[model samples]
Target: MTEGAVPLISARGISKSFAGVEVLRDVDLDLMRGEIHALLGENGAGKSTFAKILAGVHRPTRGSLALNGQPVEIADPRAAQKLGITLIHQEPISFPDLSVAENLVLGRAEDGWWSSVPWSEMTREARKYMDLLGVRIDVTKPMRGLSIADQQMVEIARALVSDSRLIIMDEPTAPLTPKEVETLFGIARRLRDEGRTIIFISHRLEEVRAICDRVTIFRDGNKISTETIDKVSDADIIRLMIGRPLKEYMHKLNTSIGEVALEVQGLTLPGVFNDISFSVRRGEIVGLGGLVGAGRTDVARAIFGVAPAESGTVKVHGKAV
Candidate 1:
């Protein structure tokens, strides 16, 4: 940030509570223009609460927010949009049945209710923004058929069309593939270069280090520290986020492996999974690993009979279940 220049978004003494339980407390932050600012914290650390306050999803219990040094109140999401603030959620929110162009202009006031719909103009505008993000998709297609990555691109395109200056992205990469993440990062960098400020809320330290200019860590409803990305090490960020050194949380335990306690053979869930076989022995731990939509949860659901497998055999302690 240049010396003496006003921060794009300045938050002071911000606090928030839900049902009388405080989630954020007396937090202060300054977001610079054209900078990708990363917010890092563990779950319930108040980072998300702060982002919501900025996005107008929630109001601060006590505090003040300023845009370019001018005080302002974001009463709701609509107000935030009017102020060029938009929140891109982890799951892109769109009407599944609606066309991409329709979703892009869903809540905008340009197309009055009494006026006839401007389908051609809407499609052209949607294409313009999508093109800016370098995403190519049929604007007339229903959002239901698009991938999560594509849905996110549409959401971002919507933001761009709204002329949002301060975009808060909440876990945008959680459901995306590595390739998708890179594409999103490229778009974010391009936006930042264009003088838009971005608030990147994520737990991914490596991603933050890769793309962010500055980082702020939160722990137990308080702001821990804000530093230039290059000035802080990953270990330092982790320590601040968890309020302890990484080693303190590392636990190692040894247990003798017993007979198989639960076993599954040839678990098949039709289109979901096929020939999934695994066993858990007593006194042992196991983990199912996969990317998003990898059927790990579906396999567990099938084994538990929540959604019974189409073809599978389950045994408990050598007896078929």
Candidate 2:
């Protein structure tokens, strides 16, 4: 951002509290025009809370917001949309049963009180936005069956349809494959080139360094520092986020392995997962590691009964669940 130029959006003295527990306190941030600004912090660092305030999902307990140098009150999500702001959630927030085209223009439909739904026009417009993002999908299909990457693309298309100047993308790459992540980054760069500001929130530091111009680190509801990405190293950023050197937290511990506490036998969920078997001892801390769409989360979900496996036996301390 240029030294003398006014910010595109200015948040001053922002503070938020939920049930008397403060989540953010006297926070300040400036988002410049035509730049992808990254917001980085650990979980419960109040990053999302700050973004939600900007998106009108939550009002600040005390603060002020200025868009284009004028004070404004964003009372709700609809008002935020009217102000040319949009939030693309980590999980696509759209009607599961609605068609892709319908979800793309869900809230900003143009149908009047007596006018008929222009399905053809809607489809065409949605296709145009999808094409701009280089995403090819059948716009007539329901959103329930679409891949996470495809759903994220649809959310970006919705932002384009709404003519949003500032788009807040919260963990947009969390569930996307590497190829999909690169594709999404390309689209984000295109949006930046077209003079749109983006608030990119992510845990992946490498992605932030690759795409963002500036980064703001938050810690325990406080703004730690805001620096140009090029001026900071990864270690520097990590220290700022966690308040300690990385080496201090890298040492591993040894523990005695006890009897099996969690055992899964022949866990299968058809195409989702196949014959997954694992056992964790009472004193063991097992990590489930996988790439996006690798069915790791699916296996966890099935074991937890959120989505029961078609054929599996989950035993907790020797008793089947």
Which ranges in model 1 have alpha carbons more than 4 Å from their true place?
A: 110-115
**Count of clashes in candidate 2:** 0
Clashing residue pairs in candidate 1 are: none
Candidate 2: how large is its RMSD? 2.3
* Candidate 1 lDDT by residue in tens digits, 1-321: 698789999999999988999989899999999999999899999998899999999999999999989999999999999899999999889999989988887646544631355788888877887888999999999999899899999999888878899999999999888999999999999999999999999988889999999999999999999999999899999988887899998888876899999999999988999999989999988999876678999998888889999898999999987
TM-scores, all candidates, are: 0.93, 0.92
Q: What is the lDDT of residue 133 in candidate 1?
A: 91
Encode model 2's per-residue lDDT on 1-321: one tens digit a residue. 578788889999999999999999999999999999999999999999999999999999999999989999999898898888999998888899989988887647533411355889878877898888887988989999898888888988888887889999999988887898999999999999998999999999999999999999999999999999999999999999998989985898787889999999999999899999999998888998876679999999999999999997999999999
Each candidate: RMSD? 2.0, 2.3
